[model samples]
Target: MRAVVYDTYSQDLSSLEVREVPKPKVGPGTVLVKVKAAGVNPVDWKVMAGYLDPLMDAYFPVIPGWDVAGVVEAVGFDTPEFHVGDEVMAYARKDVVQGGTFAEYVVVPAKAVALKPAELSWEQAGGLPLAGGTAQRALDTLGDLDGKTLLVHGAAGGVGSLAVQLGVARGATVLGTASEKNFDFLRGLGAVPVAYGEGVVERVLEAAGGKVDAVADFVGEQLETTLAVLADGGKHVSIADGGVAEHGGRYVWVRPDGGETARLGELAASGALKVEVAQSFGLDQVAQAFALSQSGHVRGKLVIVP
Candidate 1:
């Protein structure tokens, strides 16, 4: 199997290599997937560059991919949720040895996997787990969104895009910050688009008619600005580190939730939720994919097709 492998942490994307490696073996309560597509996320690059501390107990030469869409080629014993030949999508446990989905095959815990929606393509399914799950978790943490006004920063990026649609579905008046180019795209997702720049604070307030009920900062830099415009006692959440808490809001680190994944899958299947893939790369182009994600302006998820 050809997999992306990296040993050292560096800013350079070239450190990621597509090389032949032994295929992962399925264990009890696990399933082996023939990976169709793997989503590239900021965490993938961050862990690769040593921005986030890798677990000391885990071995090096890590394969850094959390979101995956693939077909189950084999299933482990005692797994009742799925069987062999199920098309599944998952966010693998961040602490696992085979976190690498940048390959032709990968193994994931059965509990982490969910049936991929029939309505979505492999690329779209690949983009959902991590970003979509994070968005779902953040929204869940903020009580009811019904009739509330919610603001999302970095609204054109992967998680923010999903957050926009999810907020709309929950009956929130969603306002989003994105570059001018993505204004229409954000609007199409049922959000009022505000240009993100020098006066983001004013723009959000203007869009919402006053202050918003809650804010989700997908872009970590605007934590203070978001907090300023939030209604008193309003909930604020962030996937980024420390900033949320520092701003007197909730800090969120996305974790795999099979139940949430199942709910999201149902929404995808029902055409209520949509996953956006901004770009696709072949497995051999893992380095290029990482570079694109690190460039900080990708409009949606970047996917590596194996």
Candidate 2:
């Protein structure tokens, strides 16, 4: 099978190259998927640059991705949850960094695989897993948002946009922060929009009619603003900042859950939740995709057709 592999960490994109590699063997309780598409996330390149080195182990010749939407080709022993020809998607992050979804094929634990909704395009499904999972996790951490006011920083981003939709579905009036160009986009997602920089707290407070009941920080480095805008006794969580824990807010790292993935697929299938794919690239052009992701200005997800 062919895959994009990086043998060593480098800030430069030169380390990533496509090459023929040995096929991954399906393990017990796992399924081998023929990769149709993979999502290119910030973590993919961050892993390549060793930014996550302290958090996870990396094996050499690592394949660089975790989000996938593909068809099952085979199943391993005791994996009764999936079978051949089943379409699935997953946030298939392994404890070790290797055998990633960027390849022509990837072996995933059956517990991590969820049926991909037929309504979603391959790119949309591929891009949905990680970002959607992260957004879901953040919302879950905020718990009981019904009839409350929720604020999402970087709300036009991949995770933040989805968070807005999820919060709205739970009966929360959502306030989202983004650049002027993305205000319309956030409003389309059912969020009250506020400009992100300079006096954002005042804008959010004014928009929310006083204070926000909950806050999800998808973008980092705004502890002061979050503190100021939050209502007394409100909940706050940050996926991007560990410092949130120090300030009595929760710090979240999204986990892979098949149930959550399936629920998101249902929402997408029902046309209640939408995954916006900003751009896509062929497998050979992954380097360019990673470069775009690192720029941090992309409005939605980027995908690779493997």
Superposed on all Cα atoms, model 1 deviates from the true structure by an RMSD in Å of 1.4
Estimate TM-scores for all models.
Answer: 0.96, 0.98
Which residue pairs collide in model 2, if any? none
Candidate 1 lowest-lDDT run of ten: 51-60
Q: After superposition, how far is residue 52 of candidate 1 from its true place, in Å?
A: 2.4
The lowest-lDDT stretch of 10 consecutive residues in candidate 2 is: 252-261
lDDT of each: 0.86, 0.91
Model 1, 1-306: lDDT tens digits are: 888888777777777787788888778888899999989989888777776664533356777788999999988877767877899999975464434788889988887888998899999999999999999999998889999999998899999999999999999999999899999899889999999888888988888999999999888878778877999989998887465786678888767877789889898788778888899999778888888887889998999998
Instruction: Please give the distance, in angstroms, between residue 154's alpha carbon in candidate 1 and its true position after superposition.
Output: 0.6
Instruction: List where candidate 2 sits over 4 angstroms from the true fold.
Output: none
Residue-by-residue lDDT tens digits, candidate 2, 8-39: 88888977899999999988989999999999
Model 1 clash pairs? none
